[model samples]
Target: MAFWTYMLKCADGHFYVGHSDNLEARIAAHQSGTIGGYTHSRRPLELVWCETFGSREEALAAERQIKGWSRAKKRALIAGDWDLISELARCRSRG
Candidate 1:
């Protein structure tokens, strides 16, 4: 089964990162607010980005890494700006 690392743009204009084996169902749950957590209260959320991985471990690792990123970096990722992402990473490391 394919696992996915997904990013959601919450109603409050914040990003939420999570991993799920059943991306569609998990997204539905979030949309309905039945997931009962952060995204739940955030209400109306948009699946801004998602990427499939070979294993749950990989997906989870990606989710965790993204969750730690600054908002600018996450925006860079969602925008598919690899150059900006790389520059952000370098700046973060140098700080």
Candidate 2:
């Protein structure tokens, strides 16, 4: 079974991160407001980034790590800017 770590760009311009075994169903739930909570009010979300993982643990780990990231780092991740992400991490560690 495959797991997924996904990021949604919400209507409020903030990002929501999550992981699920059923990516399509989970996303649909969020879109329909059935998922509720943070994403329910921030509707009309756009899926900006996603990655598949071999296990639920991996996907959950990714989700948790992403949730802690700064907005700039998250943007860098969405943009696939590994260099920028690394630089940002270094800057964060130095501070």
Candidate 3:
């Protein structure tokens, strides 16, 4: 069984980070608003990024880490700008 850490770009232009064992089904639920939570009202989500993990714990950890990231860091991740992400992390740590 594969676990996944995913990020969604919501209709409101905000990002939602989560982990799931069933990425497709979970995304479908969020799209349909059946999950009923943060992404519920912010429907019409676009999957901006995702990564498969060996375990649920790994996926959950990734989700938690991403959830705590600044919007710029998140955008850098979505854009696959590793250098920028590193720079942002250093900036955050120095503050």
Candidate 4:
């Protein structure tokens, strides 16, 4: 199965990270308000970023890793700021 790591831009100008084997269906569910909880309170989320992984383990690992990033970092990611992303990842590796 194909797994994806996804990012959502919430109403509060924050980002959410999640992984799923069915990216399209999961996004649809979230949009429909069926995927309740933290995101439910911040509906109308926009899919800003996503990456495919060959395995669920990799997708989940990336999700966990992204979850710890700062807002600016996440924004950089969504904006496809490859330079910033690379720099941040490098710094993370050294720390």
* Global Cα lDDT for candidate 2: 0.97
lDDT of 3: 0.97
RMSD of each: 0.5, 0.5, 0.5, 1.9
The collision pairs in model 3 are none
Off by over 4 Å in 3: none
TM-score of 2: 0.98
Off by over 4 Å in 1: none
The 10-residue segment of model 4 with minimum total lDDT is: 8-17
The local distance difference test score of each candidate is 0.96, 0.97, 0.97, 0.90
Candidate 1 per-residue lDDT over residues 1-95, each given as its tens digit: 99999999999999999999999999999999888989989979999999999999999999999999999999999999999999999999999
Worst lDDT run of 10 residues, candidate 1, spans 34-43
What lDDT would candidate 1 get against the real structure? Answer: 0.96
- Model 4 over residues 1-95: C-alpha lDDT tens digits? 78999999888876889999999999888888899887887888999999999999999999999999877789888899989988987887899
Which regions of candidate 4 are displaced past 4 Å? 89-95
In the range 2-68, model 3's lDDT, one tens digit per residue, is: 9999999999999999999999999999999999889999989999999999999999999999999
Task: Arrange candidates, best lDDT first.
Answer: 2, 3, 1, 4
Indicate which candidate wins on TM-score: 2
By TM-score, the better pick of 1 and 2 is 2
Off by over 4 Å in 2: none
